[model samples]
Target: MPAPVSTASALPARALLACSRAYCAAAPRSSDICSSLEEQWAKIVLVIKYLGSKRTLVPLLTKLVEASGASTGLDLFTGTTRVAQAMKTLGMHVTSLDSASYSKVFGDTWIALDGETANHSELVDAISHLNSLTPAAGYFTQSFCIDSRYFQPFNGERVDVVREKIASDYSGTWLEAPLLASLILAADRVDSTTGVQMAYLKNWSHRSKHKLELNDPVLLAGQGLAVQGDAL
Candidate 1:
């Protein structure tokens, strides 16, 4: 005869029901389903465009960590921080390190965030205002895109505007990192590169012609650390 199942393991259904009730009780009240859906979507992972970004491997890697019974993870060479962000989403305490300043911006914004520090409405308003601003040629346009074809002039100008605004107005604030990350991701989306930004297409890709837009950076509520420097 098979051995009887232990009560501790067999009570998972009861435990899950209890957990669901607790979550429902703690959840904030929202007037509309659309607002609630938007709030939930904002907490989802931000899709990053990067050469050699390991976003597709996150699920498998996360499973391995869980199987190992590891509670903490350290990500070295955390470019774009997709893996670190994924691990954090799976409830691990993650420490992410990258040498690139741009990667550090991603790490600080997504991995290090512990709950919502900035007001959502205010952030949305700020993004809307930035997106509506008229585009103009600037350093980015001259250096990377319009002058060199790394990106189209329209998108390049938008990148310059958003970057300048974030640097001048939002720097050193809680809003800075996420806002900057959003801008970088936005630019990446419209870039006319096959993968890396080392070169651009002979002509503009359909994506490059689209107006640049910013989306909210995925913010995790779990504790994390972002380090910028050589991992060695």
Candidate 2:
């Protein structure tokens, strides 16, 4: 029998390069990837705090979506719609989907809100009014968790009042959505635990600074974009 060919001689010399080229050709062009939402999300200042958010995974998730050639993104269990909003900012077709009624409320506001005119002055004034309310005596008055180093407390009644005020006063196609999302974010920021409880952090030491600004959708509307419904 003829001598067996060496293993190295079995394949073409340029096999690796050829395979790479074929892979590249079959994949979607990087230029086709949407990136606007990612850029917009990068600019968001976390006003409220949250636990277990996927914000840190944003870059990885964005890259994965881009690589997977997903033309449309549906965010199921869309907590705060952070990832979905980012995808939307990227200009990818994005739908923020959720089952919870509260989530439904958020999705409607974030995904489908609109502003016809720029009202920076008006918005700033509204934010100012919303911030003036003090913590409720009934809830904040009672401490939830106390440690030697720190204590975590919440003004439940005051928070309720704020929610009520927003429900009654704030009106927009999308203003309330981002605004509520932002507030929820802020709540996450201030809470002491990795979970949603009025418990103090074991090592709590951060400046109590409050900053508020108009969220992305409102800004987009201000820029003359027409926003519509928060449907799937």
Candidate 3:
């Protein structure tokens, strides 16, 4: 295998500038804010919980990145791209690459910067509008069931709605990508299933209940790589 590409510090200034632009475009504010650019703030929190993600690992990853001294970093699998995103936040030029289409979509939307300003209110409104869709037609409905004791129908429905919005309208930008990634995490958190099985589990379904919030896409985030044209 070849060596990986690193985008840690080179892109930070540019990414930060893009984030500010997105903020301004979204809200039309004169003052600049240096917070996250994700539209679905709740989603980011939700993903952290669902993945039982290792924030502790951040230091380790950071150390590795720092040691490498690369201008850009590539996360081939890019699950949550948690470490990568963190590195980006800390002023790295990070590029998350994934084999899975969904994972790629999420990463592209969340981490890739448009290098432009954004409209916050309009983005929020857009999310709301996209969020109001039927459950079965959405992307997260692969293993959901209401009466099987696994997923509460209503709660599952809400998750489906949020997912639908993301799949439908997660454009490439600072705000949309992270927000959608967060929503992917949120849905995984509330899923009434065992971590081992990505599907719902009837027995433990009610043991805990979760409301649809923001999250990263579990399937995409956890996927392993398979080289194309390689035989099993």
The number of the candidate with the highest TM-score is 1
Query: Considering TM-score, where higher is better, how would the candidates rank from best to worst?
Result: 1, 3, 2
Provide the lowest-lDDT 10-residue window in model 1.
Answer: 41-50
Give the Cα error of residue 138 in candidate 1, in Å: 1.1
Question: lDDT per residue, candidate 2, 43-116, as tens digits?
Answer: 12111234456777878998888788876777877766667766666556666666566665565554544333
TM-score of 1: 0.74
Q: Candidate 2 regions off by >4 Å?
A: 1-52, 68-70, 114-120, 134-158, 171-174, 196-232
**Against the hidden reference, what TM-scores do the models get?**
0.74, 0.51, 0.53
The models' CA-based lDDT, in order, is 0.72, 0.48, 0.49
TM-score between model 2 and native: 0.51
Per-residue lDDT of 138 in model 1: 94
- In model 1, state the lDDT of residue 167: 85
Model 3 agreement with the true structure over 171-216: per-residue lDDT tens digits: 5444565466556555555555543234454344322365554432
